[model samples]
Every structure is written in C-alpha cells, then in structure tokens.
Target: MKTTLSKIVLLSLWAATTSLFADSHGDHDWKPLFNGKTLAGWGVVQGYANYYVEDGAILGRTAEGSPNTFLTTYEKYGDFELKFEVKVDEGLNSGVQIRSHSRDFGSRR
Candidate 1:
C-alpha cells in the first residue's frame, strides 16, 4: 500500500510540473525593427522635418509647423507581425495609417 501511495504522489507531481510549461517552444526567431542607435532602414516623407533615434525609439520633431510627417518601413509587407514601441509628445496632433487606401483629393472632404 505504501509503494502505491508513493507512486501516485510522484505521478501527480510529475504531471503538474509538465503541464505548467507544456506550451513552451524552444524555437523562435525574433526580429527587431529598430537597431537602437540609428534609423538605418526608415523612410521619412517630409523633407523639412528631422528624425533621429533616441533610447531605441524613432523620434520625430516638427520643424516650425511643418506638414504631416510619417516614418514608414523601408520594406513592404503583406501580412506579418509588426510590433514596436511608440511614445507621442504632449498635446500633439498626429495620425496612424494601417492597412488602408487613399482616395482622390476631391473625393475626400
């Protein structure tokens, strides 16, 4: 009877331990967008504005009421995971464009 109880306890403990990390995969290839020191593969639209890297993030500041400035990816992607950290300035008006299309000037108000 003692041997059976010991086997049951060991089996229960092993099952719990294995179930805790059952979904953990040892193979993953993670790619980062920013290189943390420079904007090597970034494209900027507004020529008058300035953009630089600060603390592993792309920083863009408007140059005296300039037009809309956007930082786009140099490579085009159809469907993939794109993750990044973004911080906006205080009281700043901005916009973000995702998988979208543009219309003609007269068609849009």
Candidate 2:
C-alpha cells in the first residue's frame, strides 16, 4: 500500500554526511540532496506514514489503519542519475517514485 509514481527520473540519495555539498572525490558534479541530519526540504503531500531522521538516515514508519503515505521534495527534479541505499523490513514495501501528478493523491480510507 505504498504510494509512489511511475514515470519520472530524479535524484534521491541519503548519506551519513551532515551537509549538502559538491563531491570532493573527483566527480564534483555530484550533488547531495540531503544534509543527512533532518528533513528540512521535504514534505508529506499525502497519507499518514511517519517520516523522521535518526542515525543520519530517513525512516518511514507506517501507522495501523492509515493509508499509503508519500514524502517528496519541495522542488521538482527530472532526468538525473539516482543512487541510494535502502533496507526494507519484512512486510514493508518502499520505492522511489519516478513520476507523479495531482490526480495521484487520496484513496478510500
């Protein structure tokens, strides 16, 4: 019951670092989208899952009886290489939404 998009290309990365900066390790063009400390530039556009920062990582916890939840950046991005590390517990499904629109929101509770 996770809500995600189906046709967008974007960058979604989270690291242990504490700030957004250019990659000093050769590929200076690499941009870090998260500061790795808090969810400062992200927001929940729908649903009731809980998102929070801990150990420099973003965690999503689903609440019983709640609908599928979505957390997205305040700015829109497209056509970019995406790299990320993820760990999903049993019975939990998580994914990067590639594309989305206004009509994608809400469902019967």
TM-score of each: 0.52, 0.61
lDDT of 1 by residue, 1-109 (tens): 3223323332333343234333446554434445557767766664345666655445555555556555554654454343323334455455556664332211111
Candidate 1 lDDT for residue 75: 53
The window of 10 residues in a row where model 2 has the poorest summed lDDT is: 3-12
Question: Clash number for model 2?
Answer: 2
Name the runs in model 2 displaced over 4 angstroms: 1-28, 103-109
| CA RMSD (A), model 2 | 7.2
TM-score of model 2 (CA atoms):
0.61
| Most TM-score-accurate candidate | 2
Taking every candidate in turn, the Cα RMSD to the unseen true structure, in Å, is 20.5, 7.2
Write down the lDDT of every candidate, Cα atoms only: 0.46, 0.53
